[model samples]
Target chain A: MLKGKSILEPMDMTTAELEEIFDLADEIIANPPRFAHACDGKLLATLFYEPSTRTRFSFEAAMLRLGGQVIGFSEPNSSSVAKGESIADTIRTIACYADIAVMRHPKEGAPRVAANSTDMPVINAGDGGHQHPTQTLTDLLTIRRRKGGFENLTVGLCGDLKFGRTVHSLIKALSRYAGVKFVLISPEELRVPDYVRRGVLEANNIPFREVKKMQEVLPELDVLYMTRVQRERFFNEDDYIRLKDRYILDAEKMQLANENMMVLHPLPRVNEIAVEVDSDPRALYFEQAKNGMFVRMALIMKLLGIEVE
Target chain B: MIVNSIERGIVIDHITAGTGNRILDYLKIDTKKNTIAFIMNATSKKHGRKDLIKIENVTDVDLTVLGLLDPNATVNIIENGKIVKKINLELPKTVTNVIKCKNPRCVTSVERNAPHIFHLMDAQTREYRCEYCDEIVSMKNE
Candidate 1:
């Protein structure tokens, strides 16, 4: 059912659809070489208007592992975008050569624009901190793999909830699962947007509570998803300095967390997570990044309707 | 309440009580030189709660915006007070440069040169979505 579909938002896929992708991802992980040629003749076009080496490489590697061809530009400067071509024109041109396209743009609705322009399935890699559906898929796969299932879990989302698109996507994806509650940990200034709270959580009648300190809810969490709070998001240096240390995750803080609790970070961590906690067996961030490839591989295979060997 | 009725001007009616102030604020009606009358919190048989704004010396008002903000608003353009043009301010197919999309990551929010564009996905529901970010604007909140 995922065939010929474009994943522009996390909610685009239902809980059943997500489970199917996770099942395929598990197959890919279990017998990596068996499904290598799933997309032998298909091509993946990565049209990243913004610079995201991690995401770009993940898509290319996923395609390569699937025995598929990868083609496209890393930045807009090297593509027709530099010559004043709109995203619509760029997607149209890319769709001619690729079976599917993965796009990352600095504009919030850029991928949506591209999705409308091309016949090929358009996956939104990231769009100006708006929504990152692939990352959400990766997270869901990781959670399912690590925790056995997504239901009845208490997930704590900490740090810059306001601008963290991944957090928004994850929350939306998780809301579909049963008995899942959220402990939103962030400063008042960095709370999740009203629309997200109203549209996704409150509208769904999901149980959630907001708190300024992470320690208060650490022991109750089955998963701790942390994000960096950039200094740039704040207008004043004094406010940034005051709040910077409060959100940092250190070994001491992890002691207060549940012993079986897993910690996740969407990486490029800037002192938000201490190095000491990296050795913790529950630190699944690096593994989370690796899951990005497998999940994408499953996505490409399913979207292209390629049967696994 | 006797500003000469428009020969060809819009009369917005059945607006929710006290919302005329917001409509006035949104349109900046005072800045224009046209004759206008704003009737607030008036009783009506059609709409249990009603308000009216009558603008004279103008042919048309942006009914799309009015509908976006308040779908119940009915517009009647009078030519010699005979209701020459009557339109129940339906949601437009496309809206441009009216309200700001609150999503910070929206291209239209940050891009100074780009026009703020929105599409009316649900006409009766008064749902307007940013063309750039696909962020749905809730009129009740705005």
Candidate 2:
């Protein structure tokens, strides 16, 4: 039933279905060449309204590795969107040429609108401060492989909690699993939004605590998820500069964390994580990025109903 | 101490004082088509002061919206000048097309013809948030 399904939000698929994708991704991770042609002759349309070179490159790399062709624009100006075409019109038009479409737009719920207009499958890359289901998939896959499973883990989400789409999606996804404790770390001004706090955490009766500093809750977390303050989300540069460095994960702070804890980041980071910590075995953000492609491969094949050999 | 009874209509009682007119404005009770009588400053055993809205010869009301406006309101249906049924209103879990999301970044704001939907997250806290964006739609202002 996951085939031909539009992924507008993280809750689109059940946990068991997500695990199926992870199982296929794990198989691909073990031997990449075997499933190289699993999606032969297929086409993937990456319609990015806003330019995200890393996410665009990852989805493209995933489709290419599966022997599928990739098409679509990286920026709005390069496509018919610049001509004032609605998202509904553009996605419906693209469905004629492409088998599956992955879209990243600056407007929240743009993909959902497109999905309703197209018969072809639509995947949300990252909406404007909304759900990023694929990124949630990447985080889940990484956590499953690295930390064994989603249960009995104290996950600390740090920085820009108010506007981090990745954090919002991850919290919604992970809160569904058993024994997950949330330690929300951010300045008082930038705590997780009330909708997230009330919708996911309080509604589910999950235990969570709010704190100001990362170091105060370092040793307690099994996973330290770092996020950068997006420049576009801020109107004033001075506030961004003042608040950006407040949660920087330096080597000294990392030393206070548990030995088994894994550090993660949705990349293109701007000094949130120290360069020296990249050499540490606990740093999983790079591997997390690599795993993103594999998971995307699994997702594409699953949505296309392609039987991976 | 008696307001004339209607042949067939809806009588909204137990509304918090001064809110009956707001409901009339929201429901757009046209006085030309249907007769509306506002019973304001009525003394009640339970409420110190209460308001009532009596609409003559009207039925098939959208009870969902009335529940959101005031959870404590009561509606009585009259048929042939006799009370047929009484309805006690409770807050709906989700409301659609009622309140506009105030957030500029919200999809509901930009997308024309998009339905404005709000989900009641907390009943005790009276918290309702936009379905698309998570902006808390404060009930106090409206």
Candidate 3:
């Protein structure tokens, strides 16, 4: 039933649907080669309107590792988009050539528009500070694997809550589980947007607290999800500089955390997480990166309706 | 004080003072056929100061849309110069094509022909969010 299903946002799939994907992902994780040819004849088109080497490659790798082929542009300039071709026109063209499309656009809801225009399944890679459902899948998969379950965990989402699409998606996904307390650690200006507060947290009646410092809330979190404080997301240089160094996760800070508490970051991080912390046993970002590929593979199979052994 | 009354039309009353002209423009009132009277800064006991628009020979004004423009507004149906019916405005549930989605990432933003639909998230707060991207359509300044 998941065949030709487009994933524009995290909530595009129900909790049961998400659990189905996770279940398949667990099977794929246990034995990689058994599902290698699951999508043998399928083709994945990566229409990256923006340059994203990590996300594009992960998707391409996911498709390739599943014995499928990859095609499409890394940036808009190389494609007909540079010639002023509309998203509708571009995606309609891609649908004829590919079975599924993974699109990353600078504009929010670009993939949703593309999904509407095409019968081919469309997967949103990342839209402009919008939903990145695949990354949420990766985060969920990582959390499930490391922590054993989604319930009763204190998830600390630190830094750039205002602009980090990953944090927003993760918060939304985590809020769905029972007894998941959210510890929003960020600067005042970068606090979680009111829409998320109203729709996801308040609407769900999930208990959450906003804190300015990580130290005060570090020990309580079961999952400390760190995020880069990007300079581009800031309108003022002084505010960015002031808040950038405030949330750095170093060994000294990690020492304050519980030993069992796993640290996660939606990788390609800046100085928010120090290099020394990568060597720590609790840092799960690199492994989390690898998990992105596996989760994406499971997602592709699910969307294509390909049965895995 | 006898004001020009419509024989059969709509009397939009209790608009926040100084907003009569904007409502006229927003509603795209057809001035070619219907005779319209715009009363700005009119004294009202309920609202203290209000604006009113009385359109002659027009009775098909969209009440749901009028509610969005001015929630405190009341529409009085005039039949043979007597007020036949009165309506109190309430915020609409889903609004289409009135306001464009502000989020550049919103599907409606790029797909111009796409319906600019907004779901009323909090009716009490008059808050709406985009159906496509869930970006809260902040009412401030809009």
lDDT of each: 0.83, 0.87, 0.86
lDDT of 3 by residue, A193-299 (tens): 87788899999999999999899899898999998887766668998888888789999999999998999998788899999999999999999999899999999
Write out the backbone clash pairs for model 1.
B7-B79
Ranking by TM-score, best first?
A: 2, 3, 1
Q: Which candidate is the best by TM-score?
A: 2
Q: Show where candidate 2 strays beyond 4 Å.
A: A116-119, B1-3, B14-52
Backbone collision tally, model 1: 1
TM-scores of the candidates in the order shown: 0.79, 0.90, 0.87
Docking class of 1: acceptable
Better of 2 and 3 by DockQ: 3
Q: Residues B31-89, candidate 3, lDDT per residue (tens digit)?
A: 98779888889899998999988888888776676777777788999898899998877
Interface RMSD of the candidates, in order: 3.7, 1.7, 1.9
Q: What lDDT score goes with residue A21 in model 1?
A: 91
> Which of the two candidates, 1 or 2, achieves a greater DockQ against the reference?
2
Best by lDDT: 2
